[model samples]
Target chain A: MITAAVPERENYLNNAYGIKSWLLTRDHKRIGLLYLFTVTLFFFLGGAFATMIRIELLTPQGNFVSSETYNKLFTMHGVAMIFFFLIPAIPATLGNFFLPMMIGARDLAFPRINLLSWYLLVIGGLFSLFAMLAGGVDTGWTFYTPYSTTYSNSWVIATALGIFISGFSSILTGLNFIVTVHRMRAPGMTWMRMPLFVWSHYATALIQVLGTPVVAVTIILLFCERVFHIGIFDPTLGGDPVLFQHMFWFYSHPAVYIMILPAMGIVSELVSVFSRKPVFGYQFVAYASMAIAVLGFLVWGHHLFVSTQSVYAALVFSFLSYFVAIPSAIKVFNWTATLYKGSISFATPMLYAFGFIGLFTIGGLTGLFVAALGFDVHVTDTYFVVAHFHYIMVGGTIMAYLGGLHYWWPKITGRMYPEGWAKLSALIIFLGFNLTFFPQFILGYLGMPRRYHVYPDEFQVLHVLSTAGASVLAVGYLMPMIYFIWSLRYGKVASANPWGATGLEWQTPSPPPVHNFDVTPIVTHDAYDYSTVIGQEVEVG
Target chain B: MSEHIDSVKTYALVFAALIAATVGTTAVAFVDLGPFSVVVALLIAVCKMLLVALFFMHVRHSTRLTRLVVLGGLLWLLILIALTMGDILTRNWVGVPGR
Candidate 1:
């Protein structure tokens, strides 16, 4: 009997042990895991605030918590979710893990700086956590001026400082990615040969490096105004409150692309892999990411349409806002076309990708509605705007984040999670997410405002539905957490390429070795090359 | 990959010009050039920025990509300020009810 030899399973996981190795290691994979644990904690922390907010809104009355407490809860939720969790979610964790691997590099250009970025995030997270424990901030994540500058006594400075510190983490990570992509690609991994994930990240890093500083400056100015009684953002002084919005949105608007573009990159990979085809219009999809990033910067004025921003500026912004959607639409169309005449699988990741396409379409279309000057005047601060963003952020980004996580879980951990449970959870999340946020669109159309502790009684039914959906959404999010943890011990060991995908990462062993590859991989084919993958699958099986 | 190193003489000359520009800025601040003061001051500032970017930042001798990166940052900043000024400059136009 001929026996197949089993290779030794020494990898990043078994290469080191104990806390110090993890805490001080410059290995991007370990650093990615560090980020994973940190951001996961913050995700739940943010979710808790969201749960409280939803429960309180279950009725028209502010019974669950005081109005002041409610404000802090939402603010904390936004700050934790955006700054600590969403902003760093995919990029810090998956990007940190796979970028160097995918690009066939040993590590990011600046591995120590990558580690420092995580520390900065932790330090930043601690400041926000302290602010929360010390009574919390009422200024919403936007930290809009006048209220943030003059009124509302809360831990605004500490929270702002937390955000300020975290901004550097983003900047450092961006700089590392920029340099790595520029300098560290494998010998033959030319610009067009690189995966869409790298392209999207390159775009995201651009926004991160170029756009994040303005927000940091804005926050510093806000801190100055709040602390030293400066009038930079205060209307009572010589400064203009609108100026704060200008600077704030200058960064914040592009920040939305930062959150979604990576998700788009993930979807591009998942769609191609599960469909067993090269991405349709691959170059088009790649350039679309760059187009979205560049165009994203031009449309910040759309957010200021109702904020005493000039009609002329609003027109330009609204027009540009509509323009940005073209690239997004191009991506959506390309993904759908990739599915044409392809052997498609309804795997968990593909299901989430499908969910992303439908939900992101709704979210993107609603964004267009809000971009219109006439429609925006009515729904600017209403639940419509809230729903629109949730549809994009939660529906779009989180869906893709979870999808990417599930798709890469086998590779990341060298084990297969129970597939049935994963699929069920994906379904639950999709249904629950829609049930939760869809009603808010209707409520917003009915003139129901957001950030209010007490709403009119007419909106009670929608509030109850939303709260119920929140509970379901909570379960959906929790199920994967439990199963993913459980899989670590009981699941079957994953093979090198569980999905039969085509990428440098899949070419390496599951839970790849410390340096990722035993021999450096030289790419000879474009990304998503399924021709050889399909033929190889038959012989292997 | 190797960069061109600027000579000390060139550096000294650029430094001296920056100083002269700074003094010109201060002197112009004292005078009332009205609207042109801002224009003149911005022009001088732009010149100083160009000098630093081209020489100090090494864009003059760096790869085209590096030059593009610097240009990209400037272009984005211009977009932000210019579009914002469009709003601020035209808020009272047509006399909307809220205004």
Candidate 2:
């Protein structure tokens, strides 16, 4: 049957009532919902700031707002998007929702800490919100020293404190996922037997635990320098500002992996389930996530190529940066191979998966471009670098994030989203995303620096086109959000294992019980064991 | 999770040794072994970290996975410090583009 009964039985959602149930719930799934609601707000908040930036750039005269306002807009946009939205987007919401379920555990190892992690994120977000309301920070999200520590009179401390508090959220979430994955699997669910999604989350958790502390410490040192007259980053105070850059990028680079790895995990599940095949080189894809995490740390120096960092260090970083691409390439090749001659279905989720592969490849290749010491010299602080990261984060991660959201929405909500609207929005997002960022690559190549309110008239046409695309992209983003909400009440009910997919998650009822399963699943086959999955209605154990 | 548990005696001895190391680190500070001073201090710090991890944190009695994670954390910490210090120390070394 294509549909099943509306979830009449008590589930996680129906099992609770009132704001108190959500605000203080110990269920990982409930906390995940709490995160979903919160980060979605931050996403649009970031998007609104992005809208102002695009509108201001429409004619390239900086006429829409003052240069100072533009700086604040972009800074807050980035601060909201990166620290609050993207960093926690998939992990906090979807990962929190499904990680325990996918591994056949009752919940995360520490359910109370899971709820605490969500609270920390909210508290941290409030700090940033307070900063924004009181005339936003002007230093870019990178928060480079001297300008931030010595010169700027913006709300640097408030925003930095917000991020500092949020870093613990990341750290605790990672700690919870790691310990859970290590100890919580059901019988027969060994490491290799586990889903790639779990593997990717495991890798991301490692990065979050190990890398976030560095950034937190850097923020603390920044706070000390700014609030107290300490010289840690203030040049006049015998502190070296370049050291601040070193420490900040040290975590920020790995933080990039922290964003993409979970999304990559989502793609692994999408490609396998829709194609009706096991992942090609499952082990390679799993290890690639780890490779990216570890290698992500070694390459932060590449960001310093145009800085005061030594040429020798930059060269080593340049070389190591290319090495990180090998594992990424392996995953890309394996996914493409997974689709070869398989019964591939271009559902909404699969469509997004395809977009992820194509765009992520473009992003990863451009990464190699900037990895070159000479090439990065030309494009440093330019729109090319901006375009490159938007491709990775927006084009790549957001696409997979949407794909994962759609793939699991049935399971999460017990309702199937309107497939037609989902497909159209997927197409719109693809076209709109390309339209928005593609020209920036050209404009950057043509020598337009980022963070400038005004630019040469020669760059005006590309800027206009980019603005037009941003509007469309904004529309594309809004559609699923509207439809996803619409689906909750009006949409068709979802059957257990509606997609007929493998994994312990699909075995239980849609939206599952508060305890997750009627019985603990004993996994007897490797993940994506299609023989057991196809032509079979998955029954609750 | 580890089944093995340490007795109070083991904990007390480890605690005493930790105190001794703390005093030794300060005492060695006055010796000033030139280039080796920082290295000596760091070695003692490493020992102290290991002692805390093995005994107080119970890593020594924990599962292999737990010990590996502790070690990974230490390795990652080394990477952060080493790379940052490497860049700082090398900035003034004064070398050519390609030698």
Candidate 3:
């Protein structure tokens, strides 16, 4: 009934025709679609590399590929996945599309710069892809030096340059978001009136602007060391290798927050909407994001506990690492509290949110295990570390990415994806993900190190089980790809507010017009104010 | 946003002070103040940075948020250097008995 009553008008999708329109368009929504296509391609490319690694690990004998090829496989996997896919996953796509809409703006402050960022990412990705195709860098994604600089050689400079270029893309996007958030909110859309998603992105942008430059500088230093034979990270040339660890993790640590904060923002929206309640302690959740961004910088040393870092420094880092978890926990607790006695839905997005909260908790707790200096001595470089991050990156970020994608699909595409398939895939991903990574925690605790092509026969059973789970996870991922494409033509037409969501984004058309709002909306209610629409069916216009 | 336009006199005065500071840095480098040489050099650099930020960059005339952004960048840099120095400084506090 709601769909029938809604008028169909020319929207972003039908506003133009052909390749030139999309390629040269300055529309934020079109740019978001561009990012969605690019990142999804990289996701599969990264996923292909992951499949190779998993299959190779299916047996302890390392029968599938040579050790060197295996090294390249995992290296490319990490490089493609982290730099290309996960880091830019939500912000470049979802945030770019919706941040302006949610705050009642026509577009981001710098639309051209937004387009440039996507182009930069494409160029950067091409460079990395060229490196992979040429010979593949085998420095593990960290590109730890002396080895990266002096010895173990394979396209290090090319790959680092690729990442360096991509880093600019990230920095530019962050600048755009920061300027837009500061200047573009509609009248009455005060700081407190903004959605938690915007709040989290604002914090993420801070980290992006401040922190990405450090990694870019680090890569530059690495470039100089490798190409110019500088004595920066090479121990034989009087360089302290540990200093590389220091500089690398300095950015890489906050880089973890870069990967997860936007995901947390998505979860904040999902939990509140599905629970039909305003997010509990909204200020705490918002400030918690800022706190995570700030505190995230102080804990980089935790990555160096086993590198013979000083006991005092390690102690300081360990303590601060624990403190960083407090803000994250504050978020988790607030989401849970928001669900108390509230009308909850089992929609696909909310299912993914539940998956994120559970898996991210496990990931965050295991981080404490690795944060301890003594404990890190045992688990550093082991599958425990591998599992811990996958839980966070895959379980936490990917789950939330998928959740946000499903939550906003109606708005982005004006079609409802087959909900039954979405829910089933979410379930498969959760089960298969747990099956794949949970055993790694045990294998790691039992002293199985990572990145090995061969292992003792005793580790074979767990490896088999993990590989089986990876197969299932592969199916889980593929189903969405197939159905999301299929849904474009055949799925149910979506009303503007299919989910009864409460954001300025929902006030417009399903696939909004060229200018998002016909007239700028002045916010009159708090975010996630579902009570007003609870009993009545949501209207499209 | 600042209605106050900086006069040429103010610019010239700051420029003269910077030149003086550069000369002072060169003079200070000639005399070894033992371990404090690096300290004095860094202090002079900080003062020069303040001059540039406050006058040249017009941070002095900027809004509170702009000032906070500048300070925030500086504080983060301090955290990186100080925390890292904590590790480098005390690395061999207990040396292994033999090489």
Candidate 4:
């Protein structure tokens, strides 16, 4: 086993004085928890909007809501979930928290920029809330032209402005992570020795830095279209709406990988830890994250299959789309291989890891259908697309987020969440998630379209089933909110290494010191070296 | 360290070449290259971007991990642009009655 060069405890915990201290702190751990709290609040709010959409879909008519109101509900749901919750949930919170710690650093390279990212998130969220109160936007999250630029009257600018602001937060967070991982590793922590989670975040950060700027420009052009009537996307003004889509998806397509890669990163850690093995093909898994991120940008046009894009372009995109699947499949196979003949444990995190595997597979497979030229044309804007994304975003990303939250809760809070409730919530989330999204896949196949306030009579049964599943999904989401808060005061005090996980964070005290390590640690081993912890008698042998 | 020096020089030369190519492409755009015009401009643009990414972004100087990240972004962009264009361009190719 390799040795850890332990540093002295210099009271990094009590070094601070006020609320302002934490609010303005550059500590990665504190910033991460801060992000966790804020993103969770938005997750619930986003879910509430989703719950409303599903409830309305339970019937054929636009019951319990007007068409305009239904439009706003679904639009806000997409905006909130995509921009406010899922996009930032994993990378900004869990990745931010553990990346530095895992790399044995004091903080991200540019700590002030990190703090700015959180503030930007809060400001963006407030703008969206203001939009909701003033009325609400109904143009859908894609904000496709004609509708977003000329139609739909409910405070589109305020909501789009919020999304625009959130883009910077994403960009800044990406920049900081990239610089830190490059410049801040502890001595002896070579790139190969780093955890797969850190490598995945590094890949994700690259996309955020490069791709988000293009979207920021797109949103600006959108604002120009709405306010000034400049007609960048207005076909009447010698402008092509398709160009807007190209610009929009240019950023957005990569944005999908941005959302999923970090979750894949988190899954890597959970799978390795639970399976009691170093990740199978560590270099390959690490490279695949980057591969997915890079390839992610090329495949944005798949969203425009039935739009004004060319058939040649569609064929090429379909083929390239298939290429991206290869790297993603590589990761799945490697994870399964990692679980081969190991002393596996069924901890809360492990259950979510399994959940991620199953849901993400369904999500990925459906994406293949969407990527195909013939199939996509048949169901371009249908419920199939909706179900396809929700499976990946909600089913895959959110599951991994919660798993990471539960896995790292002890480190963040210095307390244990009730284990029984944690496991039950994971199960509920899995069942409710499948119930909520799976039926929509069939509905799409049967020709039910998305973003409609009303549907045909034939689609009602599946819609009702989907809505019923959403309620269970809500319960699944709510349990963690209840227990995690309850655990803060009443739960048992946890030691530094509650799970016997072999990361640098476990070497620090519970809840960690303000600046993270009192003095920097020197890493001399590869991550997930379970033998080191086992030799110390940390786990139940 | 030797790898770093060689890549840095390579990056610098490519960046200079990119600037020159951009100017040349814009000049050529004014000429009637027809469909080839857009293709040529894009090709030059792609080359310029590659240069910036490889040298300025330090992808070439960095480890294989970094290179993989750069490649990942490019590969995805290719899929997006290519597939979308495929559907749009092929729309009117056949005597499929609707057209």
Worst 10 residues of 2 chain A by lDDT: A532-541
Which residue pairs show collisions in model 1? none
iRMS of each prediction: 1.0, 1.0, 0.8, 4.0
Question: On residues A292-390, what C-alpha lDDT tens digit does candidate 2 reach at each position?
Answer: 988999999999998888777888899999998999999999999999989888899999999999999999999999999999999999999999999
Per-candidate TM-scores read: 0.96, 0.94, 0.94, 0.86
lDDT per residue (tens digit) for residues A1-541 in model 3: 3555666598988889999999999999999999999999999999999999999998889899999999999999999999999989999999999999999999999999999999999999999999999999899999998899988869999999999999999999999999999999999899998999999999999999998888898899998888888898888888888898998898899989999999999999999888889999999999999999999999999988888788888999999999988999999999999999988888999999999999999999999999888899999999999999999999999999999998898899998899899999999999999999999999999999999989999999998889999999999999989888888989888887887888899889888989899999988888878865665454221
* Model 4 misplaced regions, further than 4 Å: A1-17, A537-541, B1-99
**What proportion of the true contacts does each candidate reproduce?**
0.80, 0.48, 0.76, 0.64
Chain B TM-score, structure 1: 0.92
TM-score of chain B of 3: 0.91
DockQ-based class of model 1:
medium
Candidate 1 residue-wise lDDT at A83: 93
Q: Which is better, 3 or 4, measured by TM-score? A: 3
lDDT of 4: 0.85
Report the error of model 1 at residue A184, Å. Answer: 1.4
Model 1 chain A lDDT-worst window of ten: A532-541
Q: Candidate 4's error at B30, in angstroms?
A: 16
> Using DockQ as the measure, what is the rank order of every candidate, best first?
1, 3, 2, 4
Cα deviation of A329, candidate 4, in Å? 0.9
| Candidate 2 structure quality by residue, lDDT tens digits, B1-99 | 327888999999999999999999999999969999989998999899889999999888887777788888889888987888878878877865686
